[model samples]
Every structure is written in C-alpha cells, then in structure tokens.
Target: MLRTIFLSLCLSLPVLLPAASFAQQKSWSGTAEPRNEKEWIRAVQLRVNANAVNSFMTNRLAGTGRAKGVAALTVEIASDGQIKAVSIRTSSGSEEVDESLRRGVMALPQMPRFTPDMQGDSIALVIPFALHG
Candidate 1:
C-alpha cells in the first residue's frame, strides 16, 4: 500500500506542476535607442503636459494666498493610456501643494498615444514632468 501510494503521488506530481513552467515565455528583447530626437520630443511633450496641469491647478487656487516655487512630479503612464502611478519626485518644500498637483494630473484624461521612441526599429523614451512658477 505504501509503495502504491508513493508511485501514485510521483505520477501525479508531474501533472500538478504549473502550466507556466511548460509554456513558452514571450520575449521582450526588443531594441531600444535612448539618445535621439524622439526622446527630446517625448520629454518636451511630457513637460508641456505637466506644466499645463500645474497651471490649471494654480489658477484654481488663485486668491487663496498660494505661494508657488517649483516641483517635480513623476508619473508613469502605461501602454493602455492610463496613469498607472504618480508621485512627487521633488517637492518645492510644500507637501500639500505637491500632493494636490499629483492628484490633479492623475485625474486628467489619459494621454492619447504611446508613441515609440525609436531609431532604426529600436525604441526608448523618458518622459519627465516639470512644474515651475
């Protein structure tokens, strides 16, 4: 009985293994070009977007004794055109205003495109968010 049970367990162990282990993994080894015009374009666009949102937020707080300096916000937008994550990369010595701005941008509409930063089929991009008074 012990040997039968052991043999049965051994036979079923293979079946119990995860399907992922046997499945082929998709390759993400695409080429990337970090330094190029596309990167500059992406950076400019991100800066523009960030500044626009910040300006709108500042306008809303007008006449409320708001003092503005500068802040660097970091936002990650996924390929699906959604703000996946947002955080204040550098605060202008004011957490309250930084948090407000971050929330404001997060609430904005999704960016229209995920334009690839590329050179000869390789692609890379760094989108930055900058706000200034």
Candidate 2:
C-alpha cells in the first residue's frame, strides 16, 4: 500500500520577543546565527529539509498502523552547529512515531554556527512536527 504523509513545521522560541523587532531586521543570509524568530524558523526549516525528516518518517512508518499526530520536540544545538541533544516535549500518541521522529531529528548534520550576537554556547528550541496521512 502507498502511504501519503504531510509534514508541517512550527517553531516556538524559548523567549517571546516583540514581533516588531524581528520585522524590522533584514532577511537572514544563512551564514550566521539567526537574529530573530523568523530567521530562526528559516534556519530550522532548512535543517529539517536537509535532514529529510518527512521522507524518513514516511519510510519508517511504512507498513505500520500509526501515521497521524503532532510531536513537540526540544532541540539543543551547540554554537559549533552540532546537535547537542533532543528531547520530546510531547508525544505523537505512539511510541513508534515518537521514536521515529526523535531519530529523524538526531540524524541531522551540522547546522549553521551560532554567532556571538546570539550569546549562548547552545540554544534550545521547541519545534512541533505535525504528521498527517
């Protein structure tokens, strides 16, 4: 059987900042740490695409009964672009799916290095993945 899966990306910042501040900034160039929520979202979207989590989940879930739910994950990325850790803030109602999502994120390669402007050795982001079939 052929299964269809749709992946949606939603990012939640650790600290809520004024939208006006982000709106006034120039677009992120993908070279340094993201300066605002929008830029950070863009960076995360790029990393998700590079990691191919959608495809990974599709393949991983093939022949399985579980396919639809939302999983919220907390990811910590080091200044050097390495993924320091990944934890599930909310599960997708299935251990299989949750584990698969975690594995998919953990497979991500090095991301953009954080700039001094960011002021942190590592950053934690709450990313929600919506999976639908």
**Clashing residue pairs in candidate 1 (N, C-alpha, C atoms within 3 angstroms):** none
lDDT of 1 at 119: 24
lDDT of 1 by residue, 2-107 (tens): 0000011101101122322111212212223224444433432443254434444555543344425555555555543355666766565666656666665565
lDDT of 2 by residue, 1-133 (tens): 2111222555322212333222222333425767664565466655654343444445566335575666787777776767788788888798777676677677765656665455566777767766553
- State the lDDT at 116 in candidate 2: 48
The alpha-carbon deviation from the true structure for residue 47 of candidate 2, after best TM-score superposition, in angstroms, is 1.4
Model 1 off-target regions past 4 Å?
A: 1-60, 63-65, 116-133
Candidate 2 residue-wise lDDT at 104: 64
